[model samples]
Target chain A: MNFEFTEEQLMIQQAARDYAQRELIKDVLERDAKAEFPADHIRNIAGLGFMGMMVDPKYDGSGMDTISYVLAMEELSKIDASVSVIVSVNNSLVCYGLEKFGTEEQKQKYLRPLASGKKIGAFLLSEPEAGSDATSQRTLAEDKGDYYLVNGTKNWITNANSASTYILIAQTHPDKKHKGINALIVDKDTPGISLGPHEDKMGMRSSDTHSVMFTDVKIPKANRIGDDGFGFKFAMQALEAGRIGIASQALGLASGALERSIAYSKERKAFGTIIANHQSVAFKLAEMAVKVENARNLCLKAAWLKDNHLSFGIASAMAKQYAADIAMEVTTEAVQIHGGYGYVKEYHVERLMREAKLTQIYEGTSEIQKIVISRDLLK
Target chain B: MKILVLIGNVPDTTTKVKFNADKTAFDANGVQWIINPWDELALTRALELKETADSCIESIVVANVGRVETESTLRKALAVGADEAIRVDADPKDAFYVASQLAQVAIGFDLIFAGIEASDYNGAAVGGMLAELLAIQSVSAVSGIQLENGSLKINREIDGGSQTLAMNLPLLAIVQKGIAKEPRIPAMRGIMMARSKKLTVATPIEVEPLTSILSFELPAPKASCKLVAEDQAKELIRLLHEEAKVL
Candidate 1:
């Protein structure tokens, strides 16, 4: 099989890189410093058709391949990881889930707007008690004839305040454990639904993150994502897609850090020679390059498998784990290469390092990804 | 009404170039390609025209003269709003060959559009040659185009400003950047539709080349900027006259 990217993929990658450099990089540091959500940046990205890179055309999506989507994410993250996460959650976690599991009417109504970028989407599966064990969620959706009364709290959710629709998971029958979990779509403005105070984050602060509380929220039964007990399955599928996005994010952050390190090392002189001319500094750059390249390759392979409808669950997990670890390693090394300058905010490596940490924590923790890969391997 | 857009897959402008050791050709390694940015402007105008008419323009057909490697560019044109694509499967070393190949496939179209020049070659000759071969009225460096009652109204850039011209149907125009902002990235759904859209490849008629590349090289490095003291305006002017020789 040919591994080279098609011309279209290359174009998307180049366009994303160009857009990121020209549009996103200028204010990334200032926005990160102030913990401001880049609302206008998101609008620009939406205008570029990235908010729905994989959704079908009928809904006004870009309908690009999975790899193209990942490439776009990677390029965007390279300039600013915070913005990348916003796009990732919207396209992979929320829209992909709705398109795959929702009914025809659901696709027409919810998926169309979300895919078209006319509305933002958020996925709410993590609760205070159910961060990793999603089936043990405390949120409940009690049946009330034509509607379900949803009452619960989801914490640390991305895009909670700005999202127009939320794909929320709650227990419809708590006695049945995992069998009772169900996915439901809730409009952000539905009565009894309100956003919690925005979180003060260390990195990716340009993307708003907040808690969501649903108290006696009434949603029509038609809003159910899939069969009654398929919420966990839907969440898992979404997470699988989300892993690719996270991998791309890791790749982007790492590549950006590496690029900065290389440039700095070449420009800075030490002991009458460029730091890059020293074996110690040169070796670090080389290692970072190796990790970034390997991580990118893994991400591309996983995304390709997913796009082709092949078995990619295990591959996705592996890619996510490798990329996350690589991002952390490369960014840390990038900071080290900067020496004292890296500690300062003006240098930017410190910010990249902070951004790299989140990739290992969200989507799936590095530890969680390892477990997933091991389980798949055993199977 | 159907409109045909001729696109060229040219090397991305930001890419670094290298020439062969013997200087007869340029190295192709690590070269990235993109749809000529100017053609994207033309395509956008066509889409805008189609959108405003309230009647779906029958189709926007992109015709290219290249190999299968060019399919991606064709797909992009489709994604950006073209309905189908046709490839004249030949390299076409010169503009006449490309023009003749396009003339063969451009029949039954109300207008033919192209970029002023491919970013790779910067020849800027294909549009004129195609117009000559097809015996149609031609306009080059079009910054704007409008369709009305089977005629094309075009605004083209001249030396310092722009000139507007109108031509009947079955005309040719080569677009320039001042036409419009680069076309927006195709939407997700448009990309999906492009996957199944019709793209036909046909053998191209052979035409002889008139000129070939002899060599390529980087331009000379710029001289270092010299700093002149604020009080030495006279010296700066002397330097400009004596050293830089601009005065």
Candidate 2:
């Protein structure tokens, strides 16, 4: 197999790099300090057609390849994971799910706008107790001849406050367990929808996170993504690719951390010599490079599989688990390499270290990823 | 008006320079390739001109002289709004070869734009040479550009100031910064559609080489600075005279 990226993929990577360096980096420190969402950045990303990167061109998306999406994700995450997560949720979770399973009506209304970045989309699955266990979904949606009354509280929801559309997974028949669930596209303006206090997050502060509560929210039957009992399977399928997005983000964070560490080692001096000349500092940088490269290979392989329409669930899970683990490890080491300077927010390693932790916990937790891998492995 | 944008490939600005043991050539092991920044600036300006003055311009095409690898760079030009691209399949040895190959494909274009210099070699000769080869009016180091009734008004950066020049169509300009604020990044949709766009890959016409390289060398590594007490003006002066040879 050719390991080289195609011409289109490389261009997308460069675009993301330029956007991140020019536009995103300028406000990252201030945004993180003030916990601002940078709504304007979302508009800019949409204008660049990044939100609909992999959507079909007919639907107002760029109809790009999955490899391009991964490349863009990597570059965007290298500078600001807070912004990258917004992209991830839109491209990987909401857009992919709707496009894969959405009917003509669903695709026409929600998927189009979400893909074009005219509106923001959020994935609603996790509840207070259902973080990794899909079978424990507590959200309820009662069948109402022509509509469903949806009521649930989804926490740790990215883009919760500002999202116009939500792809929510709720139980229609609790007795049937996972088989009873259904995924619905709910508009934010629907009655009985409200938001809780924004989560006081430690990292990715530029992303708006909150607990979205729905009390007697009514949505037409047309909003159902597929037939009844498709919610659980839909979430599983979406996360398989969503994992790749997270993996790429992790790889980008690791790469950025390694790059910063290399620069710091070259400039900072100790004992009349540059720190990079020291064996210990050099080895740390080496290890960081190794981890970043390994994670990148795993992510690209998984993306390639998905792009070619092959079996990618196992590869995606493996990439997610490995990349997230290394991202956390690398960023932590990057901070260590930075010494006391890294501990402060000004050095940026501390922020990256914090950003790295979310990849391990979200999309699918490391433990959940292990479960996915172990199940596939044993079979 | 039809526009032809001259695109080139150069090593990324950040690639670390590492020479082989004999120092004959650089190791390409991890060197990343990117569109030359100057060419990119020129391409962006041309595309912007087309976008704003769509009624005046008919189409824009990009041309490059490199092997299959450079097709990727040219594809980027297409994604950035070039109507099509023409790539001459050969390694460009020098500005003369590059200019000759470009002039062959650029025959019918009403306007031509290129960056003032490629970042790799800093050889700022390609545009002027191409203009001379094609027997067209040439402008160098252009910045601000505007189109009027079937003609153009452009700013040329001169020594310590900028000058405005009015020229008609079939004009060739080699541009520097201020031609465009920042090079436009190709939107994701543009990139997705770039693959199937009309990219005409033509074989290069043979031409005699004008220059050859002997060997490459990097400047010496910077030496550490010396700190002197505030009262040591005489010592500083003496050191500047003897060590720096600047007195």
Candidate 3:
């Protein structure tokens, strides 16, 4: 196994770093405080072709490998993970899904814009009662020949108001349970579609998290991603790949906090010497560094497996669960290293701590990851 | 007007500089390389010129004097905007040899832009040597450039202020920051298209070396800092006057 990153991968990392350092980081503190969407930043990154890094070039994507996408994700998340989540959903869930399963006409009409950053896309799966138990989808879709009328409320939608296209998972045959679920591509401008006010989130507040309600929304049958009952498999596969994205994001958040602590420790003095000279403080930094490195290896391994068309389900689960846990632990210690400043918002570690919690809970919760792992082992 | 931008390979800014055991040379293990920042900015401006109008500025070419590693940087330049790249196979003996190699490759181009100095060595010599060898007027610390009528106006930063000079085609320039507002990051499509873009490897015109590296050393580290508590104004003043020797 080669440990070195390819030249193209390194270049992608540099481009992402340059853009994040120059543009996304300028007003980031203020934007996080005000919970402002980075529309301009998104547009600029789109110009760099980050929005659809892994999609095929024929479909307006950059046709990059998953490893490159993960590298970009890690870089973007280092400074502003809220912005990275919006990017992650677009690339891992929306773009990858449509490219892998959607028909040619579907790809031509919908995937191109999402791939080109002309429009944002959302993947709708979660609901009030179905967070971890996605199989219990309550959203209903009534078939009407050429179109299907869908009525459902999806909670925790990442780009609810901002997205132009949505992959809505709804039940077509309630009698068949999960086998009845169908995935439809619904436009945001469709009739009877309404978005609730943005949820006041503790962290990642800049992302447009909301409850999207569709009342008798008519969707073209042609917009279905695959065969009638392919929604469950499609979602499972997409989330398996998407877990790598979240794992990389978590790794970024932890590493960013650790880097801040390292810089601060050398600069902040306590007893006639810098705090880093103290063994207690120095050991903590070492531990944080080790954890971040470990998490990066696991995350990259998962992404590398997927890029090679290998079975990555178990590897991805482990990576996400491990990285998410490490993110929380590392950020907490990072704030502690800041002393009382960690409790306050200005130090930024507090924000990272808050943001890191969601990584453990979203995509697939730590508990669900265990289930995925155990199931793979049993099989 | 064909513009040939000279590219240089330098250590990434974040790489820790280290000297060898005998202090004769820098340790080369696991060193990361990147395109010299100033040359990258120059290439970006050349592309910008071509982008604005296709008339005088017809094509942008980048030339580098190194082996495969340096060609990797040129590929990135291609991804950024350079239409053609010429990689000369050589060890980059000195500024004169590098300049001569570039001078040979830049024979047909009307304008040439290169970084004022390479970050690794800070020699600030290649651009001037190219001008001297090619028999063309040259300027350094160029911050900005604009195309007007049939001539290109160049802006240079001097000791106290800035000045602009209009120069005809076929002139060499040593450029700094204002050449472009910012260097363009290669787009994904650009990186994709770069895989197919023409990267020509040229036979180096051998030149006798005029200089050679001798030794390497790192600067001294800063002294340890002393913390001054909020309540110790008198103590701080005493130490500042007695120990620091400034009152």
**What TM value does the first chain of each candidate achieve?**
0.98, 0.99, 0.98
Candidate closer to the true structure by lDDT (higher is better), 1 or 3: 3
Model 2 global lDDT (CA atoms, 0 to 1): 0.90
lDDT of 3 by residue, A222-262 (tens): 99989998898889888998898899999989998999899
Q: Which stretches of candidate 1 lie over 4 Å from their true place?
A: A6-65, A99-109, A133-136, A142-148, A172-180, A219-234, A260-281, A304-313, A335-350, A371-379, B53-59, B100-110, B146-171, B195-203, B221-247
Q: In candidate 1, what are the lDDT values of residues A77-172, reduced to their tens digit?
A: 988998999999999999889888889899999998888788889999989998877779899999898989999999889999889999999999
Candidate 3 CAPRI category: medium
List, in the given order, the native-contact fraction of each candidate.
Answer: 0.40, 0.92, 0.76
State every prediction's TM-score relative to the real structure: 0.83, 0.95, 0.95
Question: How do the residues B28-133 of candidate 1 rate in per-residue lDDT, one tens digit apiece?
Answer: 7888667887777788878888877636468889989999877888888887789899999988677877888888998888788888888887889998988888
| Per-residue lDDT of model 3, residues B10-122, tens digit only | 88878899988888777767897888999989998888888876787878989899988787788899889788899889878888889888888878778899899988888
User: Rank by lDDT, descending?
Assistant: 2, 3, 1
Q: What's the lDDT for candidate 1? A: 0.87
Model 2 Cα lDDT, one tens digit per residue, B22-44: 77666768777878898888888
Judge candidate 3 at residue B213 and give its lDDT: 76
List-wise, what DockQ does each model earn? 0.30, 0.75, 0.77
Off by over 4 Å in 2: B17-30
lDDT of 2 by residue, A1-379 (tens): 7988876777788899999999998989999999899799889989999998899987888888888888899999989999999999999999999999999888998889999999999999989888888778999999998999988888899999889999999999999999999999999889999998988898999899998889999989989988898999999899998999999999999998998999999999999999999999999999989989999999999999999999999999998999999999999999998999999988888999999999999999999999889998898
Where does candidate 1 chain B have its weakest 10-residue lDDT segment?
B184-193
The DockQ-derived docking category for candidate 2 is medium
